[model samples]
Target chain A: MSGTINHGLAQLAAVDQGFFTDRSGGGCIQDNKLFCPGWVADNYDRYVHPTLQHLVLVGSAVAAGFLIAFALAIFAHRHRWLQTPFLAGTGILYTIPSISFFFLLLPITGRGALTAIIALTAFNLQIIFRNVTNGLRNVPANVTEAATGIGMTPSQVLWRVELPLALPEVIAGLRIATVSTVALATLAVFANGGGLGTEIVTGSNITFKTGIIVAGSIAVIMAILFDAVLLLIGKLLAPWKRKQALV
Target chain B: MIPLPALTLPTAAFGLFGDAFNFVFDGREAETGGVTVGGTSQVLDLAAKQLEVTLLALAVAILLAMPVGLWLGHRQKGEFLAVSAGNAGRAIPELALIALMAAAIGVGLVNLVVALAILGIPPILTNTYVGISQVDRASVEAARGMGMTETAIVRKVELPLAVPTIMGGVRTAAINIIATATIAPLAGILTLGDFIIARNVYGDAGVLAGAILVALMALALEGTLAGIQWAMTSKGLKLKRS
Candidate 1:
């Protein structure tokens, strides 16, 4: 136990201390060859791996969350006993603090990307499940009635009619969840998995390097690009709704 | 204005209560002098600051979004933009925005307010646009045909009618902003997140306390917004819903 604790402390120290102290150099515009800005640029790739890891962690969590949310929605929809308790439970889960949840599970999950992913996925499930439930529920009664009256099985009605109508909201929820998972994924850096947040943490530890600037810029660019792409996708998929809305 | 302060107080109170409760919880097992409550004051202070920041951002979003949303709604352009921009806004994670804001402005309340503004914008903007547009067209047509000016029709006919729906968006935006505002401490802001982050650094019972405090803060925001939604939509104009 002492060995494990020492190893964890040593690992944290390496990331927290080593990363900060190892800055490139200092110089003004024309006075010297190695400037902080140039150093930050030169080390861009150092950030990429952590960022990629963060992305993978988030991507996996979102994928898992969607599956769970979808299954739960279907189960809750069919099971009369599950609806209220499921909702109440998820709603409370929705309230759990991410830090508390992460720490509570840290001893078991052993920190790193796994803990972040688990916490994020669990938190995200609430929103996704709620959205799925509402999306499925909101299919016009007329359409469902027509499907049932035509003698379609329950499965056929769900796959054919309800799912299609629910697509807009479900897709919207997925988009939101994707963004959330991406953002929260950065917090994984605290667990030593590394991400843009590592840069922020490192930058704060070393006041001179402007790691903050570099990290912040990359985070902004990612967010803008992510938002723009999702907007494009939402528009393309929901052209019918968009046209109707415009009219 | 009266309603906002009245609405905000219980949240502030509960935030304090939650922080106190968490503090006791954190101190329970530890030796009397050794136990630290872990910046509960900072969290409370941050909650107040966050509430201030949220109100400021919401005020700005409401100001900008209402006019544009109302105009678009009047022009029947609410739906397209609502789906496109609102979806995109919702998709741009709050943390990403904070990081971006912190990058652009450096870390501080300014960055936090900007990040939250981004988070709070979609709901208010979408609701305003949708609410005004969703107003009964016949009512608008009849009012216009009766010689009401376009501006008057909007101010008098559309806004009042759209209030309930718009209020829904505002309520959602406020709650989202409040919840997200906690993340501000990641950037070194002295908010409730400080407690959470500090506990992360210390690994003490303070972590649980901080978490509970933050949750209660969230609940308080949730209830206040619900009340605001009720008050704004309620027909009889009662000060209290009951």
Candidate 2:
């Protein structure tokens, strides 16, 4: 019985020495361990702001891109001649990699969220615009003619009939754009437009694995959430299609 | 880190661009050693390194992704796998990918190749499957009726008909790989990105120069691939000239 008490006291001493304690107390950072669980738990608060910044960046860029691309698509839908130029313009922008696009904006906009957003918006143009145009084109001719026979104006037919049907493809484009932007926005660190990448790239130690893992995981989760939400929105917009599935 | 007096305006920016252009054509002096940093030869060498690394990765990806995509496509299986791969690929953060890979597995040429090849695979795989799936089923039936071997049918019919779509995937993969390669310097390989990444050594002009050159290279590569894809497409299959 006395020996058992002594052993318990010895184990307590080991805990006191910090062996049983969290590695966040310093040892993990010192050793540069691959993944310091304790260190991550302690340090995760630092990533919150950067994560928010990343969200705002993606939201603003995609919103602006959709508006611009949607307008262009509508206008081009009427004027067939505009299609080639619009496609060519957006195609060129899409071909330029986001990192290069970011830096190329530096001289013009300087480094900040504006530069990052503009660059990201430029990247979104092609994907969303193409889908919207294709969706508009793919609207069945009979549906339009039926709407016209019902005394609906051309403008009414487009807004009420064509745009609603095009929602599926538009949402698809948004999902692609949004997911890609979530991934691409990490490069906003280069523009000094803070994001999770700020944590991944410019920490006290950049190659620190735990920091990268934390940031990357958050970005990925954000992407998945965005993709799911967009998909749900698409289904909600097309309740008729959802009901069809029930049958 | 250099604090310039007043070069933020567009005019001043244009001047900087001019300096960047000069730096690429005629090398600028290094801060210490009085050596030239960027000129034609050095830029060309780094660009070449980027291309070499890109091609190596792309070749590996084609070898791995194509066969699997083609096989699955032939078997008409793994639709979920093929489709999800494209979305999942888009979701991977490029910066974190490189940083994490470098941190987790030590950086080298071979390791970099592995990183880029994996990045390039999904689009190639997805596109290959979609391309093969889109081939007219009747044509495959016709080939089979003629007693052509499975491999022969795949090679002679599906591949030829699917060239446009298949090449579209290659173009996407190539653009991605080449783009990612501009950041290869972080992993210890010297590429054109060194000029941009190492701003302290090369200054703003070199950085700007690096950005322009990388953009041009990516666009040029895309254009060349489009041309090659156009050539590879069979004449009878040329329905639309988009």
Candidate 3:
């Protein structure tokens, strides 16, 4: 509603100020606060972002995507009839190009965080679903049977046995999805969702400047940080691997 | 909302002038006329030419990545540098890197290839790393224990085991590179994206047409790679064919 209008107007204003205009001489003159000149301001508006907004968009997408993936993975595994078709369907969804999906989804959902989340979630499902299915299925049948014999219900078996066993692989999938979603989230910038890509696109259209480079670098750095954090989490969760307990 | 009619009117009118240009000076590269036909023709030619470059870049990337990735997989900690460097590499956007490279080496395909090469590296590296790392440890140890040399172990055990995963990574990488390659037109190399970007400047129809072409090109590439990936990786991997 009101938020969409403001977002559009802001982007339009950014475009109109000639800030994203060809080399130099625009509203950017007053905001020469950019880190570099000529080389940076080329498309300043597109690249510039307040750090909080960038993190919030990326963080929320990753968190929500993880939850959705977890639920779908469990649903697919419990119902054999649903497993094959569910996994295959997500696979096809994975192949759709991001921009086309964005455009297609935009008409239905409109351009905003929701569209970006839906798009990213769809892209991530295949990987997460595959990993979760494999992780649970790979859990030793002996272990599941032992739990059942011990009078555990299916839910108890899943919660207490299967999930713990599958945690390592599941975490690995999450790591991949996190890094991927962060990078893909940049495309949302085109819809005026605000992230690192805005800087890169704006920088290219204007005189190349350091601000644009910095912003772009920051985006990359954020992605790297996300990767590192996920890797660390994977390591922490899989201490058995560190202990040399299993292959 | 400009609506469809408003968007269509100008391009439709320009279509008449473009048609006239085709009628009068279509064949000759007449130095004197302000014929719009040349622009349209050049755009088409450039789109095709860019495709050729894309194929070249992709072929080169695959050829180069295969050996390097396979080699990296044999080591105990093969993914160390690949993952770390790739994580860092993702931070540097293709557009910035292209500009920096174009500035350093000048424009055209050289810059495009170099930028694409850098762009192409991460997926190949990550895939090779992941694929090789995922190789069954016992199978690898068994090969090593059988008096197989390190090279033999790689060639016989690790590589075959890793092929599917590595190929999957390649498939993903190829799609990514193709999608990003559209930016090459901005560097003044007239790829399909040039039409979209240029038309974006002119009006929506040109941009729309450009979008259609780019989408088709990307879809065709993805399908081709999917087939290739299926052929290469389907041997042992129980990938449910879509």
Query: Chain A TM-scores, all candidates?
Result: 0.77, 0.86, 0.74
Residue range B125-146, candidate 3, lDDT tens digits: 7778777767888998898788
Best by DockQ: 2
Q: TM-score-based ranking, best first?
A: 2, 1, 3
- Candidate 3 residues lying further than 4 Å off, grouped into runs, are A1-48, A106-114, A203-207, A231-247, B1-50, B75-77, B89-92, B99-106, B129-158, B194-199, B202-216, B233-242
* True-vs-predicted CA distance for residue B224, candidate 3, Å: 2.2
Candidate 1 residue-wise lDDT, B112-159, digit = tens:
776777777777778888878878899999999999999999988888
Q: How much is the lDDT of residue B63 in candidate 3?
A: 76
Best by TM-score: 2
Screening candidate 1 with a backbone cut-off below 3 angstroms (N, C-alpha, C), the clashing residue pairs are none
Ranking by lDDT: 2, 1, 3
lDDT of 1 by residue, A1-247 (tens): 9999999999999987766455442332133221257666546777786667666776778888889988999988888578778876766555554544564444345456666677778877877887788888878899999999999999999988888777667766776677666656666554554566676565334232255555645655665566567657767766655422110
Candidate 1 segments whose C-alpha is farther than 4 A from its true place: A1-40, A79-110, A190-193, A203-247, B1-22, B25-47, B77-88, B91-115, B146-152, B155-157, B160-165, B185-189, B200-203, B234-242
Residue A11 displacement (Å), model 2: 37
lDDT of 3 by residue, A7-84 (tens): 999998988765445555443434543344554446445443434456766677667767877888898788878888
Model 2 global lDDT (CA atoms, 0 to 1)? 0.85
Give the candidate order by descending DockQ: 2, 1, 3
| Best candidate according to lDDT | 2
